[model samples]
Target: MTTVADLAELVRAPAALSVPGDVVAGATAARALGPRTAALAGASVLLYWAGMAANDWADRRLDAVERPERPIPSGRVAPATAVGLAAGLTAAGLGLAAAAGGRRATAVALPLAAAIWGYDLTAKNTAAGPAVMAACRGLDVLLGATGGRVARAVPAALTVAAHTWTVTALSRREVTGADAALPLRTLAGTVLVAVAATASRQRDVTAALPVALAGWYVARYGGAQARVVAEPTAGRVRAAVGAGITGLPALQGALTARAGAGLLGLAVAAAAPLGRRLARKVSPT
Candidate 1:
């Protein structure tokens, strides 16, 4: 159970997804489009931590309803402390981005901060929430690209955003508990659409495998969920997917950034074998 007493822990949601590996992979691939790959990855991961904290703070009350165990409502964290931490992290993330890309990175950071804060405070309950989430995803990509000095982040940013909507939707299935089937199907559809969009870039059968494998993962575990209790099954499914997302990005960065599509396939194949231990991008919970 996510609790309020543990607000410090809330920041890790976005952070985990950010560094989990696949994002690093995507960022690595995009790094060639810029100048400082490592800096961009660092800033991007920080941005993710800040974004999650900001969102959680904004939605703390709502979360208490669905996830009373989350640090805030559970009394594990002080609201003021959480707010300060979020602000500090947000500033740090932007500062890093600015250092790497100068004014251009700062420009990108403003909208990202606004979008992340806005999503948490108000937009999440509306139809616009999902778009806001996608925007953050796109911004993360942009931040990573800016670090690498790439001005042409539009295509990859859009590609990542489209898939982000799926993740957001999949996440929606889990509130007080996790939902199994619909989210999986939605994830499959989203991945396919993203892969279809990928055709605009990769233009090879190899590009298709990631989506196909993702779809297979969904289908394989989605139905089996009926056999187990909702909480545990959903948690397991989320864990696998989460671990895959976390690690594959790093592997993808290595392969795709280096122009090795073969390596991207290897990342997908290796996703399940890796550990899902989530590390903090900021204050560890």
Candidate 2:
């Protein structure tokens, strides 16, 4: 019988801490932050967990060779159970979106779900893997903007997507050690993402919080990637991936602050250290 721990590991429960900020950032940008925002963030978490479960299901065979200790490979969770959980979570996520934001949220969520499954089943090993994964996160941000001006959320979505692109690109090297070029390129991308997050036309005191959060994000995630550049081993690469996962809340908070939600952004940024602490136990990657 599969234990709760098995299920948690299968879905990467700790990593879901990075997901709600996507919704919060989007809603703040679109001026849609309200009661429904929490529900939509919940929906994003469900979809993210669904994607993680589906990823394990799809990679069960490969994982047997490369990751024998994984839930599916170790026989802690059956393949059927993982796929079923994935489908159920996907359905639940869409239903929650429909309930929270009606047709508008569902409309965006449908594509987001498709993108998630598409990335797991078909796109993960291809050259387009990072882009497809990034699209899922971008769409997730849009899902939270259904109640307001979605167009206003585009820059935030793109910023989140760009950061996700770097993470996903580096994730591909988790099992197989990469050359120095890979981490070097991703480190450069991380710097660009931080700059984009900090850039503001107003350039007043309002930008201070976002700038500080962006700096925090770069220091944590970029610092890990920098280590990988020095020694591109599988262990260092995995550590970098974990850092990217846990460091995402700072990026999200930066985007939220840039959208004029300073206190809420700070609240969102608080998840970073908590996520890092939890990751030590559960392994975010």
Cα lDDT of all candidates, in order? Answer: 0.56, 0.95
| Candidate 1: residue 106 lDDT (0-100) | 79
What is the per-residue lDDT of model 2 for residues 1-285, given as tens digits with 9 covering 90 to 100?
999999999999999999999999999999999999999999999999999999999999999999999999999999999999999999999999999999999999999999999999999999999999999999989998999999999999999999999999999999998999999998999999988887777678998999999999999999999999999999999999999999999999999999899999999999999999999889888
Off by over 4 Å in 2: none
What tens-digit string does per-residue lDDT give for candidate 1 at 178-235?
Answer: 5555555554655454343334345666665555544444443333333323443555
Model 2 vs. true fold: TM: 0.99
lDDT for model 1: 0.56
Model 1 TM-score, all chains together:
0.70
